[model samples]
Target: MATTDTQPKRLPILTFCAGHMAVDWPHGAFWVLQPPIALAMGLSPSQMGLMVALTAVGATLSLLPAGMLSDHTRRRGPVFAGTFVWVVVGYGLASLAPDFWTLTLMLAIAGMGTSAWHPLATGTLTQTMAGQRARVLGIHAMGGTLAEVFAPLLTGVLLLYLDWREGLALAVIPAAVVGIIFFQARDRLTVETASAARLGDLKEMMQQWTSKTGLALVSMISIYNMAVMSVLAMATLYIVNDLGFSVFWGGVAFSAMILAGAVFQPIMGHLSDTMGRRKIFAISLFAAAPLGFAMPFIGSPWVAIGFLIVMIGAFYGVRSVVLASAVDFAGKREGTTLGLAFTLMDGVGALGAFLGGWAGDFDLAYAFALASGFAMISGTIALGSTLAFPKIQAEPAE
Candidate 1:
């Protein structure tokens, strides 16, 4: 946990963005790789479901303890570097996995590493300059979105030339290289820590999230995440199998979605600050519902790509705004709020993978319909909460 009173330097933000791009390189590939791995290993759809769910669940279960430990510890430099190292190790081990179970385990380990990233990075950025929270977070979110574009394109290319396991080894190299660089530049990136990152603050964390506004927003975010993650777990497979496209086309479609987010996330983040966050969030959810519902039926890959672009760009693009909203809700508990938000959103989101896989076992249309419905419900909840609360910043008591 780092701290600051004034505006933060740009180097640290760039460094975090670089690290984000590197780590998510492998993470973004996971979705693209799933279908091929399932085909090769003869896995059932539900078992395929376990791959993403367990990875997220592992991340979710481990987050609280890590979040607690990070709170009490003052040395964030090592924590940041260690996260990259953890990812490198996870991917390295994954490259050597002899079976599906081993591969899943390694991916889960990687998920744990990915889990620490947002809480550490977002907490620091949000604390650094209160005035620029949404924009900074948007830039940070953009880094992951860029990875979303690059990873599949790279992975899709790699699969044509190398063994899949060996291709996974490629992810380890860049991540480890970035980790070493971060270790060397750790001082420049460090921020001051607050006591809230304490090792025994479970009660405090619960108190912040238990309020009416908090519960409503969290529920909306959770359901929204479920819809997004479900699409992530299955979209590539749908494009490749249902639409009769090549693996490369699947990657292209996935990349299109991410590219849209990369381009629009910052703009939306900035917009959320000026417009009401609840309004932006609600609009995003509502706009995406119909797009998600129509994606599976589009038939043409190019047309389907348009659907994903709109959904990922317009619908799922509220990531930073929602995060800023959560920060507004947190007030003094920035670290605790970010950690809990990350954990709960992801933990609940993991269920979407399971549900998506289950539904996809039958028809992808069912999965898409489920996604559309969830999106509408999420938007509805956000709108109702906005009307009920009427205040964007529910600052906790001092």
Candidate 2:
């Protein structure tokens, strides 16, 4: 295993963690306000859905390239720098948008920023704590979950006190600070940890998709992402438009779900680290399916809110378990493998978001059912793949 003997103490990990946290904040904040933002901008629900889709588009486009770049450079500086700048620019553009076209372009740029972060960050985390990949990834992933939990609540509060533009502008500050930390920690990043694998090497990796465990993990990721995106993008709309809830209550519902997930993610990750990824992965998915299916049936607003909390919590908790399985299957080339799987899964999931919006427009209950079906698909994939994958044990640091 490669080592970063000369790297600074803990600053690199701390800074990278902060950057991860900051990137997801805007996503959470924006989604909570999406319905109102669409109304305020005079856009249709489908058009608003497209805006959310565009971010995934940006992320999907960048995933493979970011992984390749991280492998070649072994340094996270460039990735973090690009992500921070593009996110800030994207938010600024979103703030200044005069029409849907401008907003679309802005989101596309922001999507690029969002896209750049994961592969590089995941790669860095894997490298930084080589042997303890699952635990570290869990810790890193928690940062994003934390942001998801807070962004909607903060955005709602800011919107209550100030305008959307002010709220968006305020959102950029954290990214800027994250950027500074990334730059300061540049010296601590080890270039060798970035695999010297060329594009040709990645091509060879693509050929290894014959591995049943790898394929299964990827399949599970796809189903899970589809379910997650569908819910995140459309839940607020359902609450606001169909259930007769105010935007504030809608935001609260979104926040509650995220908070539930945020609380459980680290615990799930830790369990995956200790109890075996497959066991936890299967349990989470199986539990989440019923919770998801039941979401739209509860008529009382508070009951619906409570159900969402349980549903999203189970969804994100299982997500960590599934992602850890990727590392388990990838073994040596965790970055490339993780990146490729995520890109494909999330790309397909983006389509799920579109379907969700369409479903919500017709019937919110149907949309919830659709998400539940995907969760069931994910659960099945996890159960079928468990026996095929090797048991993963954390490696001792070199």
Q: Which candidate comes out best when scored by lDDT?
A: 1
lDDT of 2 by residue, 47-151 (tens): 666666666766677777787776677555666777888888888778888887787777667766776788788876775566566677767777787777778
In model 2, how large is the Cα lDDT of residue 64?
Answer: 78
| lDDT, residue 339, candidate 2 | 75
lDDT of 1 by residue, 293-334 (tens): 876577676777677778767755788877888888867556
RMSD of model 2 against the true structure: 3.3
Best by TM-score: 1
TM-score of each: 0.93, 0.90
Computed on alpha carbons, the lDDT of every model, listed in order, comes to 0.77, 0.72
Query: Per-candidate RMSD vs. true structure?
Result: 3.1, 3.3
Error of 1 at 101 (Å): 2.6
lDDT for predicted candidate 1 compared with the true structure: 0.77
